[model samples]
Target: MHTRYGSINREMLIKRSPGWRWIDWEELSHYRDLLYFLTIRGIRARYAQSVMGVSWAIIQPLATTLIFTVVFGNFAKLSSDGAPYLLFSFLAILPWTYFSSTITDASVSLVQNSLLITKVYFPRMFIPLASALGKWLDFSIGLLVLVVLLFYFKAAPGWELIFLPILLIILFIVSVALGLLFSAMSVQYRDVKHAMPFIIQLLMYLAPVVYSTHTIPLAWQKWYVLNPMVGVVEGFRAIFLHHPMPWNWITTGCGVSIVLFILSAAYFRRMERGFADMA
Candidate 1:
């Protein structure tokens, strides 16, 4: 059978390669608005009916900081690297909370938004990325509380403050990478949803969130930097508590984060082709 348009009749065959690319940047860009809306929707859904609303962000880190002050600061006698114990613990908790929360949400973002996944053709990566974005707003609010603590303590960041944004980007990279990897896996195995919080809780102790890295033996320091958040939590305290930048930890951690991001992106891409079907 032949169909004619105007004066011409033609038959065309279209084909797509069997293999998928790590990312379709152009395709994602076309859906940027969708990403923004998803992020906004997430934030709203979180606080829409809450009594405390956005204040929950501040309360979470603040409450954790208070507990850590009693448990680690007074009882354990861990040094705060110069700043008061409250500021130090909160700074560490700041990034740690952001990282943990983002990862937790991203891990289940695909499952939570199964309806959207089933109905959409956009980049599946957006689900995890949008999950991260929602948490960034909470992080920003918690950061303001940190600044208030700094002023209350009469503390200010040194020249190393210039590296604050870079450190946050590194934190974001690692969190998003883990989020992508786990979110994809969760689509196939529902257990990731249940275990994610416990995993984050265990990671908090291992990553130097409640104590300075100075206490860890020098011999084990390099091996400890293998946890990317070792760079993030410590780097956060270094900048916020007005201490020297730990170049060794930061560099190694950043490198590891980049590598993980690349690997996770590839893995997510491979798994995402079946996401809508699985979801």
Candidate 2:
């Protein structure tokens, strides 16, 4: 329709445009309720049709810890900085599992919700963030298991435990940042689905979940901290097991993670406009 001034309406005009648009933080805030609903829906769907349900969360990490203790701790005789190998490994696994699962689910979130993407207009970031929340349920279950394990081992965490919550916050941010990057890429490249498992598996080994960082040579220690999870896994052990704080590693890793987060957020916003069409 023409404007009252007799010019064509700007809104009705079509022009071929390319390149990214700035992220609209206000629009995302306006959709906060929708994000909450999606998050709740995701959490519910996770436990809805399972036989063991939430118990699997406890079982998976518990079993992994046992296996690592036997193979790496007993057979390989890996050191855990004087703490029991089982305790050290389980603490590391808790955060590792949460981070790994969140990234995996968030990566494919958009494609999995293609029906919604194709038919609706909403903040696309909610899809991946919602999936990440679903994985948090698993983290909660694992955390409970960790408490029980500590009780069984008769190991009370010391004052260093105070740092755990801060470490966890950093872990969550790193996961979400990496998740957002992969989620955006997955929209354009379906191969990410096939490759994600191998990538995660490789990351698991690269992380110090099964072994102590103390085993690494002094020369390699600084370089090792560059892997973001190095800080997270080691930080967990240092806090819960009362090992010396890996301050240099934690500081450097946190800095790297923040940079990654900013870059990922910018890239995600830049590519987000094409998501609906790509999905």
Candidate 3:
């Protein structure tokens, strides 16, 4: 009887080991309230007492669309794959702005919250996640502008519109992946802070934001898709402009991006233990 009790106790311990030894999913769930609060805090802090408030969201992307329309649409005579210049540029800019801004903010979230890091014991992931989530507000506003532009141009989205949400989710994941990777690097190297803006600016031109992917040679298209954003930008145009979905490129880019996200997340968690001390 005593031997039976010992074996049963051993089984109980083994069953409980996961809860004690590994990632505590339940613990994270319990902190859902905390995540909600942090997300709200980030949103409020962003727009607090700003003159334009949420309207800044619409203005930023709208202004970029206008500039691109002049430079690329008029002077450069860039082909927009039969779509109106304003409509073409606005759709691409919407996702680009969201990705760029989220990446920039998330990469610095920990450093910017150094005080909170030093003082508190919440999950460090919350900082970047909250920053990324906050940008959705801007994305939402930009989306509204896109709809208005479509109406003014008398253009209706094609059947490919069904894929827009999926493409946006992929873009979001890509942005967060890159953000976490850089955020981890930034903790160790301050130069990344200074380099980020220039890097993003360069990436913008490299992406098909102001022009169509059709401009690139067919032979080189596969290689260009390796840029990841190549697929995203093209995919956005395909959906919004009634072009065929770049399925092969989108698949390649989304697959690579998802892997990158997983790897970057692992790296972040591994390094996260040291962040409180380092920050």
Candidate 4:
């Protein structure tokens, strides 16, 4: 009886230990090659049979920026902090596009990879991570357009450009956090994927993508930065347009993004165990 029990325990241990752990850095490291493979797969899958292919990246944001310039910049006469309306709108749209795509892709990653989730035993976060990374590749491609727009408008890059990476890291953290949270919930509810586009649209307006937050009444602006993207967009413009960088807004954005990221990641890890069953 003792020998039999020992064999069973060893089998259980082997089966369980090889599976994902809660925030296991070492295990994730072991599977880094899989992450690379999935990320490249995601990029290829995005443009697989499309004729336009990766050019779609620049076209989407460029088209939206042009529409915003005509509608918001021309018709509504929205302020762009004295910058050229087209360049102003494009800068905001750039980051917003990156953030929106990251969340959208990452949120649906697990459900979309249902077969892999059930058949494989790896850190499922890789699904979202790879999705986010693939989208990051798109964002990098899109930046070439932004550079062209900057030269077209004669907008000089500012010293604050150095801080752009830090800001992007914060935004990326929030994207992954929300992605993981929703991806996990989506496995169970199915409604999350349905609602995500609408939710992201609402968030885009709340952000300063189309118009400057300065257009808001002074009293309300303080409450507005609570949205996080308020600071993010402002910071981006400050870099590209060489506008003023308010320490207060940047600090608030960094802090809020960090806190939300941590809480969302914890929630995701808690919900992750059920993903295989529901997915």
lDDT of each: 0.88, 0.85, 0.82, 0.83
lDDT of 3 by residue, 1-279 (tens): 344233555443322122113334554665668878888999898899999898989889899899999999999999988888888888889889988998899888888988998898776777787878888888988888888888888878888888887788888888888888888778877788999999899988788898788888999887777767878888887887778899988888898889888888877776677787787
**Of the candidates shown, which would achieve the greatest lDDT relative to the real structure?**
1
Residue by residue across 99-180, what tens digits does model 1's lDDT show?
9999988999899889988986778999999999999999999989988998899988878888888899999999999999
- Candidate 4 deviates by what RMSD? 4.8
Off by over 4 Å in 1: 1-20
Better of 1 and 2 by TM-score: 1
The candidates, ranked best first by lDDT, are: 1, 2, 4, 3
Model 3 stretches astray by more than 4 angstroms: 1-27
Q: What's the lDDT of the predicted structure labeled candidate 4?
A: 0.83
TM-score of each: 0.92, 0.90, 0.89, 0.91
If candidate 1 were superposed on the true structure by all CA atoms, what would the RMSD be?
4.6
lDDT of 3: 0.82
- Candidate 2 wrong stretches, greater than 4 Å: 1-22
What's the C-alpha lDDT at position 30 in model 2?
Answer: 74
Clashes of each: 0, 0, 0, 0
Q: Which of the two candidates, 1 or 3, achieves a greater lDDT against the reference?
A: 1
Per-residue CA lDDT of candidate 2, range 23-136, in tens?
A: 667668878899889988887787789999788888888898899999999999888888888998898899999999899989988889989988998888889888777787
Model 3 residue 27 lDDT? 47
